[model samples]
Target: MAEPFWLVRPRHDGGSDYVRFLPSQEAVEVREGSHLPPQMPLLKRRQWLPLKEAEDCRRHLQQEGGFRSSEPLF
Candidate 1:
């Protein structure tokens, strides 16, 4: 098992939609549905959260928001 982490997906309109809990940092990425344009460069924005805060968010999203971590295709 991997440590829990929150995955944030920004909406195309504005703000963000809290995605799900992820297993690792390597799994984080801005995909097609994210706020960024398809041709936009990646990692233009980054937010670092403390371990405790991240875990808390992960649990909240799971219990309250009914979000689940998405498995990478590769």
Candidate 2:
């Protein structure tokens, strides 16, 4: 079985408007709860592709031109 990947959409402003990329169903449950870490935000994850597949896909995108050089270091 392949692991699942999610498309995390971070909350722009306040309120509830974000997404996350999780690994497992159990992880989803844990993520859904409001007991996450302090630094971590309260955004939810939207599953997109399998983890294994996503890994390969991400790698391919990076190898090609989908990856960015620098992502604005906070």
Q: Using TM-score as the measure, which candidate wins?
A: 1
Cα RMSDs, all models: 6.7, 9.0
Task: Give the Å shift of residue 23 in candidate 2.
Answer: 4.6
Backbone clash pairs for candidate 2 read: 3-51, 19-44, 20-44, 20-45
lDDT of 2: 0.35
lDDT per residue for candidate 1 within 1-74, as digits (tens), equals 25433445445565344443334554432222233334433334344455566567567766776555654312
lDDT of 2 by residue, 13-49 (tens): 4322222234564333112211133345443433456
- Between which residue pairs do clashes occur in model 1? none
Q: Which number leads on lDDT? A: 1
**lDDT (Cα, 0-100) at 13 in candidate 1:** 62
List per-prediction Cα lDDT, in the order shown.
0.45, 0.35
Model 2 worst lDDT window (10 residues):
27-36
